[model samples]
Target: MPSPDPKIISGNANQPLAQAISRRMSMHRGVKVGLVDARVEVFNDQEIFVEVFENVRGEDMFIVQSTSNPANDNLMELLIISDALRRSSASRITAVIPYFGYARQDRRTKARTPISAKLVANLIANSGIERVLTMDLHAAQIQGFFDIPVDNLYASPIFALDLMHHFQGQMDDVMIVSPDVGGVARARELAQRIKAPLSIVDKRREKAGEVAEMTVIGDVTGKKCIIVDDICDTAGTLCKAAEVLIDAGASEVHAYITHGVLSGPAVDRITKSKLKSLVITDTIEPTQAVKDCANIRIVPTAPMFTQAILNIWNGTSVSSLFDTQTLEPIYEPLYPGLAIDA
Candidate 1:
């Protein structure tokens, strides 16, 4: 028998995305899935407050919170809400974090440094969330940090479909480029999906928040170059990479990023850069600046969330929603014990 329909609870980080996902869930199941009302606030003294208004006892709960900008407050909101659901006796609680914050800090590069991503994972797990459903984790290995099931969904499938529809005849003229060596696999998968040639950007980061140089590994001359990456913060590396591509005689440069962490001059940089357009998913709430940037476009991720949540609720396979070669779900467990059938 199918499990009970899950209740959709949202956070303040990305209300638009939450509403879209909630609406789509009802549209798909042909039933209005009850949404539990949640209130999150901060006191003037800097304490966080979260409350779930509706009764969730004995219910399957799904909390939608993107730990995006204002990362601390939003992260607290998600953790506190999960703790509340656990205290309230919710049968199963799954955290739906569209864009996980602190994910980039997954490893330790120097001595006396902390693996902050693992700490965040431990915090989430200790808060009592049985499962996590997130999109395009910054580091795939971070899933091993948690003891729960994580669904790490990819944006490549949707991106490929959109690229095919928009650039049907000119697909041959386009070359998919990874912004760095770390993203080669991601870009290669997308390139294969769209039937385009692959290129890699060899970039060296001098220090935190600074990229020294970037060199293209493959030929981009006379081609329409499309740079792809998981996150775009400050737009520094990406814009510079586009300039390099243009200097290499590429016809045009475009970017398709999964998360748009457009912080600190990102909009200004993008507006003045050589990029023809920047396509990002609606995982992070777009500020007025992002919306006003004529060259930037946003794609909806609600449908993907809807399908994955539905499959989880129905106890069906979600493998088809992940990358074709990887066969990994949105929430992939890093540890062997985290392999939960749910």
Candidate 2:
């Protein structure tokens, strides 16, 4: 017997992203990959309930949910939804979590600290999720926490494309700056992609979410600096790093962050900061305050996620999405014989 068609579903966390992905899938496949109808609700007392309205028996399933802001609530919803799908006899379930929450707590910094990332991984796997897909984890090592397959996608291709477009003729004047030493690898990758110089922001963090005594580790003088990072929560570190880069003689500072957590006062800080612009992806849903920020821009990840999902479903190479020579998206549909309408 032939395998059943793939089914895409979403929890309440990021309905817009899920919808975008579904639209792209339908467009690319030349067939409707419509989102499966489901109802996810929370009780007044804070309990979560999930009900699937369509039959998913023996069908491949993908759940799009970002464990963002209300991390616990969203996480619970994902787990509950997964449970519902599994109980309904779905052949395989993939968790397409654009932003995996508690990822920063992958290891123990203090004596009593728990590895919450590992715990979350266990919760996801135990909930019968057969696979996981996420992007730009705070720490890549968190991939090892999952016993099942985890595809950790990169956002560098997206950022590199945007940078090249914005700096079309001025590529020589650009530099990629990692907000801190730890992210140098990520920054270096982007720099290599755009053929730009690499810089680092060396800083000491006296506490979480705060930076102190930052210094530039490379010559950013007279360069248009692009700070690359995974998450931008609170925006304290980002705003402070932009200030430090400006003081160090950068011509202008911009940021390309993957997950925009934008927690308390992040929008305000980005608005008042020295950065010329902040480019972030729609991995996490943007609030109204973020939408109104004049200097902040949001790029859609639906197309990238759509391609990755198709490649995974078809057992093709997802890494080939980026061309090594040009460092741009290849733009070929993963599904064979499906012409993209111009």
Candidate 3:
């Protein structure tokens, strides 16, 4: 018997991204394919239900869902979807989580705190998924929590390409700044790619959700600075860092963040900050407040994800997709006549 064609489905967490990925995949191989009809219902009792319209038996399945806002609901939806596919005898189930929620809770700050990230990993492992493909996890060590293979893609390459255009022919005036000590390596990678100096903000947080003070470790006088970080929740850190950079005589400040989990007051904070602009990837769908911010811009991850999925299906290295200076694909599509549309 012939093997079933690969199938891509999505949950309610992020429909726009799912549609984008689905559309590109359909164009690939010149074959007409769309999202698998899966409906998620929340009854009056707040119980969750999943319905898969198409047969997934013996098929390679990829479910694109992000556990973003309303984290619990989105997370539960993903687990239920995975369970349904497993019961249907899908040959393989890979969870494509663009913005992994609860990633920041990978470690415990106090004695009694739970390692929610590990718990989430355990839950997904038990959900019958064989592999995981995600981007810019808050903590790299979170990968170790899973028994299955995890492919973590980076948004640095995406930012590198955008930076080249944003500051064409002004490499001398550019610098990469990390908002906190922990993000130094991430900022340095972008700085090296752009051939600029690197700086860091030494911030001391008194407690969770409250940043006390920030000091710029490097001279920022008369240079355009770009702050790089993984997650932006309330925008407090970025806003304060931008202020400190400006106070240090920096000519201008901008930011590039991988996952824009803009929660309460984030839009307000960014709007009033001294930064010239802020750029974020569409790992999480932007809220209406975010859209209203004039200084904020969004970069699409559709192309990167499309190519990454192709790489995964072909058993090739997904990391190669972004490491190149040109941000071009290192491996060609393995399937016969399957063109890279995005």
Task: Please tell me which model should have the higher lDDT, number 2 or number 3.
Answer: 2
Per-residue CA lDDT of candidate 3, range 72-152, in tens?
A: 999999999999999999888999999999998999888999999999999999999999999998989999999999999
> Residue-pair clashes per candidate, as listed?
9, 0, 0
Each prediction's whole-model lDDT (CA) = 0.85, 0.88, 0.86
- The parts of candidate 2 lying over 4 Å away from their true place are 1-4, 322-342
TM-scores of the candidates in the order shown: 0.92, 0.93, 0.93
lDDT by residue (tens digit), candidate 1, 63-158 = 999999899989998988888889988888899999999998899888999999999999999999999999999999999999999889999876
Write one digit per residue (lDDT tens) for candidate 2, span 76-179.
99999999999999988999999999998999988998999999999999999999989989998999999999988888977877776677778899999998
Give candidate 1 regions above 4 Å deviation. 1-4, 323-342
Every candidate's CA RMSD: 6.6, 4.0, 4.4
